[model samples]
Target: MNTNKTELNDQELSRYSRQILMPEIDYAGQLTLAQSHAVIFGLGGLGSPASLYLAAAGIGKLTLVDFDEVDDSNLQRQIVHREANIGQAKVASAKSNLAQLNRHIEIETIARHMDEKEVNELVRQADVVLDCTDNFASRFALNRACYAEKKPLISGAAIRWEGQLSTYDFRNEDSPCYQCLYPEDNGQELTCSQNGVLSPVVGMVGSMQAIEVVKALLKLPTLTGKLMIIDAYSMMIRTLNLKKDPGCKHCAR
Candidate 1:
């Protein structure tokens, strides 16, 4: 992300008028967003809404990464891919839809798996990264990469009417990385495919992820050192403070 200021044209001003009206994100904040770049590491339930909202919010560039193909089963929750995109790659499908949403922004698609080195390179180029991936392996990989690059990472997960969101702003000295919260991957990761999930649960989480991304770009207060737990079943939401692990391998100095 370039700290250099960006000027919005008349059409852009008109497009994001509603957001710019907010005192927290006035013209200056919108300009910051317009000059920002975000990298998203999934195109499914969480990535779908997160990408859509970011693009709609006028983020200058977005790099979408996913190796999976769109399946008919994905249509139930992966709102970014339509029926016609069932056979297409998830990243390709998401890029096409996101382009339709905001033609002014740049959309990059990586429709293949990325190794740790490649993930780190991508994180290095991004102002922020969104860990929308489902599995523990992917989450841990992203956490490592973001911490190495000192990029803010907004992670979201949803399954069986339960969703959680957390922002690891590695740019902050005391901000905890994802590994600080989940220290071990016990090979028991639960996914929506295994456990059923309500459509709106992911939507709720993904939308919140987008909000945190915008707040991050604007240097506004975000959920950097806390986690938001959502229980749609009971209609309750709670916040838990997260402390950096002194002995954590990923972020410990």
Candidate 2:
């Protein structure tokens, strides 16, 4: 993220004119967005829209991390990939598509999985982290890394017509970490492949994650310490208050 570049060029100004028109996100907010960097952990369903919107909205830099390859089955909900990219690594595929959307922004790709040290270093470089991974292991690893680095983490998940979104802003002393929300990870974890998910369910949740990321970069009010549950089958949404766990191994003092 180049904080040195304080001004938006003519083309950038015109490209982001619509979002810049809003009262809250005027010129300044857009510029702030242009200097921010976001790291997304997955390039699947949730990450597809999240990365697309962030790129189109002019996020200065995006680091994509995913070790999986694009399969034909992923085409149903992973909108950032195409049939031509079916055998390509997800991070590579996403970086290619996102670069096309916004040529000015920098898109970095890590096509392999990383250990704890690497994850922590990546989190330290990002202004915000987005957890779009599927399994509990990846989520737990990312949560620890973000909490350790004090970066805000925006996590989203969807399965079987249900989805959830939350932001854990570790910069705040009182903000809850992901471990506070899910203390115990049972061995059995549900997956979209097994239980199945509605296409739009992940889309809605992923889009919301993008909105929260923009809000986070602009220092605007965000979903910090709150969990949004979406039951797309019923067309209903609800929010729950998230409290920091005093005994949480990751965030507790």
Candidate 3:
């Protein structure tokens, strides 16, 4: 991971003044964020908040991938899409919002689902990969791609007042990949469409996903080998340590 060592411009210095004041994220840290690239799959509830926060924080390049259009039903939680964006491509809507947030950064949009080859190539170029998709198939594909590229992936999911988040830094050989946590589909795929989710439930989890991405770029201690489970109804949160499955197919090699 190259820091680039480029000095922040006057406008940049003023824009990130607040973040630069922090001990953990001084001007150097902010510059690191400015030089990093992140790709996020799925522009729904989770990706919405994650993209917004990442753009506001000034990630140099943000690649957004999603093949869905903005549905009227999505406004309740997908904060990045407004009522005007109904029926519009999610990536286009996201690009408009992100462009408005940070004109200094680059925002790339792919308005289609990525195939395996596309996923691998894109993951190879990104410093961070965020799996915000809601389906197991996409999650598994992203995990495989990230593991191949040895990129850090920040994954999050929310449905029916329940949410989960984890970061897999495949660059670390001992770290567990996403497959380690869910080896196979157990017939337990519940989506917000079927079960319904609290409005803020996704926001809570998505914001944390953004935090993990930022922390990962700064090389700060992050949730790399742990899973965070959240219950919005009970307001309870728990973290579990993750171990690599020696026999796991994706990362055991």
Best by TM-score: 2
TM-score of each: 0.97, 0.97, 0.96
Most accurate candidate by lDDT: 2
Query: Model-by-model lDDT, in order?
Result: 0.92, 0.92, 0.90
Models sorted by lDDT, best on top: 2, 1, 3
- Comparison by TM-score, 2 against 3, better one: 2
| Residue-wise C-alpha lDDT for candidate 1, range 148-244, written one tens digit per residue | 8889999999999999999999889999988888876555788788889999999999999999999999889999889999999999999999889
C-alpha displacement of 235 in model 1, angstroms?
Answer: 0.6
Q: What residue pairs are clashing in model 2?
A: none
Candidate 1 lDDT (Cα, whole model)?
Answer: 0.92
Give me the overall lDDT of model 3.
0.90
lDDT of 2 by residue, 1-253 (tens): 6688889999999999999999899999999899999999999999999999999999999999999999999999999999999999999889999988999899999988798999999999999999999999999999889888889899999999999999998888899988898875555789998999998899999999999999988888888889999999889999999999899877886
User: What ranking of all candidate models by TM-score puts the best one first?
Assistant: 2, 1, 3
| Pairs that collide, model 3 | none
Model 3 per-residue lDDT tens digits across residues 1-253: 3356487899989999999999999988998898899999999999999999999987888999999999999999999999989999999999998898899888899997667998999999999999999988999999999988889999999998899999999878888998899985645788888899998999999999999999988889889889999999999999999889898877887
